[model samples]
Target: MSETTPVSELNEAEARAELARLAAQLQRANRLYHAEDAPELSDADYDALKRRNADIESLFPALKRPDSPSDQVGARAADGFSKVSHAVRMMSLGNGFDDDDIADFDRSIRKYLGLSSDAPLSYTAEPKIDGLSLSLRYEKGRLVQAATRGDGEVGENVTANARTVGDIPHDIENAPDIFEVRGEVYMSHADFDDLNARQVASGGKTFANPRNAAAGSLRQLDASITASRPLRFFAYAWGELSAPIAATQMEAIDRLRAFGFQTNDLTRLCPSLSDMLAHYRDIEAQRSTLGYDIDGVVYKVNDLALQARLGFRSTTPRWAIAHKFPAELAWTRLEGIDIQVGRTGALSPVARLHPVTVGGVVVSNATLHNEDYIAGRDAKGGAIRGGKDIRVGDWVQVYRAGDVIPKVADVDLSKRPKDSVPYAFPTKCPECGSDAIREDGDAVRRCTGGLICPAQAVEKLKHFVSRKAFDIEGLGAKQIEMFHGDPVLPINTPADIFTLQNRDASNLARLKNRDGWGETSASNLFAAIDEKRAIELGRLLFALGIRHVGEVGARDLALHYLDWDAMAQAIDAARPAALAQRKADAAEEAERQAAASDNRRARVKEARDAAIANSDVPPAAASAWSDLIGIDGIGTTLGLSLSDAFANPDERRAFDDLRQHLTIVSPDAPASDSPVAGKTVVFTGTLEKMTRAEAKARAEALGAKVSGSVSQKTDLLVAGPGAGSKAKKAADLGIETLDEDSWLQLIGDA
Candidate 1:
């Protein structure tokens, strides 16, 4: 699914896959910021990913993994620096994206504190500095050591580096006997600009932003290098203290200021939620003039006692939340448009932009959505950007918000270049020269060429060896690309990967003799391949790179069938049944279209006839077909993708060839004894007790099969208000029906 795919629209399979992808993305983002000190994600984009992860977890709490995005904070300490175990962990704060989120935070605090809804709660709101977090240790008014926040608990020892930062006090007076003052090490806007200018003059490597500059400078292995860089520190927190400095948050900031530390003057003590919000706005308004980078406003309970009562939740303080700013927009010239092909043969259009900075990240490219979006229309033909089409050489406004890739939000006609022309999106795959066609319901055009196309073939191979799939440790993406493009030892398929060592054994020019390959490395590569010969059924299935068969779906199939033979036989038996059902579904759809538009009925009927006549699908055995899709959460839609993967001759041959090289492990059966266990359940209409996702998660957790629609195999239907066709169908089919309240009682959620 696209990053912009709505959370509500995603099915269980999609949600699971999306969550896995997000985990990898967020982890990489953490490394980029904390380890490498080269931040790639903008504040808005990073905030969006976290929000999406939270939303999905709320909806499907059962599927939440141990290493969820929420659990990640900073990366591990870098190689050169000595690791320091923190006495008190440095934690990240939860974020609030909107005004409602702020209100919810307040309400949650009040509820947790057992206060009335209208009870007044005081808070201290301060700018969330965009910089490297530093912990400065001072004992008896003398600085001793300093460290960077690394994976929360352990940090890089940078005592010498910290001493070079200008705003950091070498020694402070009137401080606690043991004080670990925590603060942000940042480079001011003016200093950063001047530093970059000097770097350019000397042909030195310049930093991407002030935050990165500060981080890189402060983490330098050489103290002299850090001394040469202009960095400032702002003391706002304390990690470990021998004695309490103040009773309130604001007073503590003042105390830090009094102890020869630079503290934000904009920090305010808000007596009410409105005051907090007002202060946030005031700080935001003054942000550009502040001379330093700040992404959001951090709000914390003012009273220390209340803060203790609120306590913490793993990585974040329950008493505080960061109210993040919205997406930032920047104008850039549209240089050109490029078409990129993926594993699925999706011909995605990307805008090549004149490099411009948006919220600290330099973006030279943006996703154009699709041809419809370039023409200023949505999938539904609705006007977007006031119907102004994007073109090469046009001045376009790009925004990075909830999107992983920046998008062209608006095009300025006033700055249109006289030589600009309408972008002609490619009609064929540039890599393989194959026809690219857009399917009826699909917004993006896709290349018709499948595995034969190098773009799709290489991408599929990459996915086959992805971290969540086969995960051949040495055969990462770059290695996969190198192996695929090898003239003699080319790995074209999953089967080819296994056969490589055997093929190389017979070749005159050996793999070890190749450039960048050593005898030990070659032997290790072969050993890694041999090590994975006996593979888990779920991993094997997922590694096949079958359409719609993600990690969770593969596991579902693995658990259901237990072994490979059973799954293959069932798929073979169900083909005929699926064929008959498809025709019936087509007729039903045509009849509905007849009511909506008389003209579409004939056209749809003709199309259905053409599809059926051309289809080589054999009739299915009703029982087998039902069992194939009957697995809980493996509904008809995902089942169809699974079926198609095996039903096709080429794909089946490839699967069998790959299977020959591996010993597959059968998954353990779910040992649930609940009343709803193994029952096919369907949820429909406006559920008042819980959301659709919550309902699905509950049913699945109790070992029930959750289906999106009603069928003859459906055992139960949980109907809420406004339940329509599904409810009537359940009644007609004699399936058991339950209300929202009844469902909750049955699932023990009540």
Candidate 2:
């Protein structure tokens, strides 16, 4: 439906060939980037290849198989740790930009069940910690494995390093046979600063921030190296589990604490949205005081059943959302505004200010963002005159959003001097002397200069070799800027990076004579460059300088495609064919569905006659309905979401992407040691017989995974009235399930 021309059609053989080629190419790239920490391509180039591969798959849906190079989820085994396969796949959460998106998720839950708006709902509020995700597994009440959240199914083992954390328990009493707890691995603010100070003192590379350092440290090949770093853990979730320790989310936190895991004590339980908002505000007020990093507060539906009912989205759970705080603000004087041209010829405004502190750092300049951001008025209707025209004597408000770069918020009109006059915005680039044009619906005034502006080249080069890019060791942002436009070292593209090796001898010679550039460190820098020749696929993709592609996206592309050659070929050939096949499949599927519907209607008459002859419903009605509704852990919402997605043509196509790339290898889909495997059981009306929690635990111990409701496939349902709709649905489905009494009898008999 997009305006762009559809891709070409390809035969199945051709599609297969292209996919194969793409997989191999991408896989090689991934090895160089992720495993070796070197890069071969820019982010832009990688994104283009990914898009091409996606197009090919759109045409050839059947070819979009899981385990492709394009689906780069987990990396190869890290050197220092033993690898562990996850009992349950740890899927990443989907993101939302606004409150409306959250409300829509809530509505989806209602549509699945025939629920009205008044149905009471509650959510738990916790911080969305900005750090590395980890999984800790326990067996026989003893710590066994600690793993990074690799590809969701398999991860790098870090048990030895994890054991070093004082908060993690090495052993516990009365523990389940298997327990997998999930948490964030982070470096505390104080620890991060101290670590950086040490790095500076030792003349070693310092990380940009704590999050980066934590990830780097935890991923180190040596457990001893990880133990040396100031790392901490906070438990947030659980996977592969045996017993229920908590009745609610809050109680779960307490249980984790009792087990010797550290959890954020800042969590609060609120009765209403207003109260939740108040808590959010309180946290915002104390944001700077927190010892660790957090981007926002995550709100989750508190009730377990309700959360189950709300269920999960493809990426994130609908039961939870992150509420972010307002951007930090500060006041300062705007002395001047300068124009800088970009690679794409867009003119950007930079505001120069008298050095003023915002948050904790001195900011002498802030981004004006664009003409629209500057000239567009706020909700109160105050105009945003361009920062360029503001007189030198005027005061301005500066603000930083989510710890990002500062931006000019507004000009304080009250602080304007009587002698000040309104100045005109620039019509040309300040750096390149090129004509500037303003496009329709765009606030940006851009210069026509491309690859010609010194500022643009400097910024681009800096971004290209950034921490998340090629990750070149010697090329810091300052060094890149310093070399920019210098006649002696005029470097621009990624190719220029290779050229630097030629200057190694001369650079080392000059290093010994230069300020802050000693011979030993210079030698180390070149050696680091030599060490990064073989980059991984994902890192190569990230380094390509693509618009909108980041580290995570790059990784996704590599896993899905597998290798660079296959990826490149797919882009060059299969896209057109894949798209065409998708359209044909949609039509064929529709016809099949119509035929199936007709068959179902014919079967309905037979079903009615059979029901009348069987005639047991009159006596069975009461318990049958209850049994249908009494299955534990199953919810109507999840069922409905699954049904709707399967039923819709477009939704199916969209989810087809996940199917194409995601390799959900079930390690134990059919439980082997299930405690209640071959038993008939049921739960019934508010029994004090055993708490549902205790019963479920015992049943699982006996090899059972409890079903939410009764059905032909169900062995039993524990009934509780208010069992409501589930009971009726189960009876209609005609499942040979049992009730609480029968369930108890079997267990007692055992």
Candidate 3:
């Protein structure tokens, strides 16, 4: 199946087939990128494939193979080098992309430590070098061995190659008798360019980038080849220290420098988050000028004691985070524009661009946002960048940062062709030719075709079987597409998926005999479908893919309504309530318009009046609307989306038809016998013994309502070390609070 195939369309057979394909593909990629240092795929493409594999596995948990790529990290150590197991593992750091993410990281740390926001917490910020990691072991103040960080637990021994590097000190003074300094092995940009120039002159292979050059140089089987290449090392951390080097991370870095090791010059100890971010910006500003390449900045808790207390997660340190710079930008020609219809019928425009490298990843497409963006106007209709509209032939800047979708940043007006014309935004559904409407306050224009729109119907069906929705085993995007496209064995809707076995059995030829399907696999698929006949109410609601009803929304609705029948009824009742409110608003607008004395006010009043009239909701429907909006986390937008989906005759009929083929089970009520049963509980900070998800799941199992924030209604607050504002709020509200250990005791898990 193509990567663009929706996850919902894949049947069990297709999912299994895809899983096997992903496994083989990722394994080869890992070997090429990690072992051979010759990656064929871009990091973005590789990540996308991995994410797709994970999503499929989530949707079909039973089909998760023993050799699943998600469970592996990097390729096994190349056979050329002797493997040296690490005494203290050199772990990677998790990433923080934006200011909010950095703030959340700090808040999370404070919460985990049970510290107030204003408490004295400091962090050491340093450039995160874009190079290979290395560990240098020293005994009796003399370098004994060096190794590359191959797979965390064990690494390839590069002692000979490391010894050739000028930055690596053969001996140290005033250092711990035994120490293992963990740092990066890198080639400076100048040195990399020089080396590449020399290689090209000598008719040898040229390196792609500095990082690859450094990695290739270090991994050379011939030590003399590494010796010829200019390599440098920067010691930032240590593993298996014989004695304490310093009390804080910054002090230790200084100690490392004193011991004849180089450290990043820009490394600074920031007293607070503001200082840290300022330092980060400063480093980012100086990044290009710096001889060595750096992708981002790493921040770690300054206090050694605090770092110890924070400890480590499975693959990364809890006390440290890498705040990456914004994605690199590149000017590329906008080839064309394509409109993609979502499950909700929202038409999103995509800018097809000439292939260009941005931050080492190839970019061929970027999101145009909406019609306003295409017309060189902001969402509010204000001119953007002097109202320079992006034309088909115009050169546009595209950017991709962290996990964000690639987006068009700006259009180069100078590069726009004289013949370029303003792109027309479609007003009709491309799939069904129905009117595509732009609702007031909505940036997107959506099709009113509902299920009749092939794009909308296909997308909705895909969403229904997605990982976060019904997650039916053996039913994935490819299978859905295949079955939906088939005239003789069509699976057009969620209900149709359930009727597949019956339809296949009635056919002259069995599905088992079809190309890519065997008797056993077909039987397994049927069994998988049968297994999902009874599903959770939340999953059922989420599967519907109502415009604004996301996973959390579905859960909130399920928690509030308890039963599918109740939720359906509430949504049905909300329609009239919403209609009634609209009518009441229209009447008020009419009075305001009549009393308006000026043209501007009259115009404003007229718009309001028009909006109210068009809404056509009766005031009597207010109660249902109120009930829906009253649900925690359910806002007016989401409430209306739910009501509208239920109110639509076509959608309601589809849902009714689907419900008949399945059993919807309500979640069990919170346990009443337990001490915290039926009480609202809020968890803050990082839990020590278990993850926050695990804690929440356990709490819900015992009948407690786990809320995201603390309030007066909260009976208890389970605070971890970095409990920060939530703990303070709980204290101020007079709600009882317990530390991780105390909460564990209360839960009888201590």
Q: Please name the candidate that would achieve the greatest TM-score relative to the true structure.
A: 3
Question: What digit string (tens of lDDT, one per residue) describes model 3 on residues 214-313?
Answer: 9899999999999999999898999998899999999999898998889999999999999999999999899889999897899999999889878987
- Candidates in order have lDDT scores of 0.81, 0.59, 0.81
Model 2, C-alpha of 487: deviation from truth (Å): 56
> Is 1 or 2 the stronger prediction by TM-score?
1
| Residue 716 lDDT in candidate 2 | 54
lDDT of 1 by residue, 390-475 (tens): 99999999876644357788999999988877778889899899899874445888876777788878777877876677778678
TM-score list, all predictions: 0.57, 0.41, 0.71
- Residue-level lDDT of model 2, residues 669-720, one tens digit each, is 2344543564534444454344555576567557554655455556556666
Poorly placed runs, candidate 1 (over 4 Å)? 1-71, 74-323, 401-404, 417-421, 576-623, 670-750
Better of 2 and 3 by lDDT: 3
Which of 1 and 3 is the better model by TM-score?
3
Residue 587 deviation, candidate 2, in Å? 37
Ranking by lDDT: 1, 3, 2
TM-score of candidate 3 relative to the true fold? 0.71
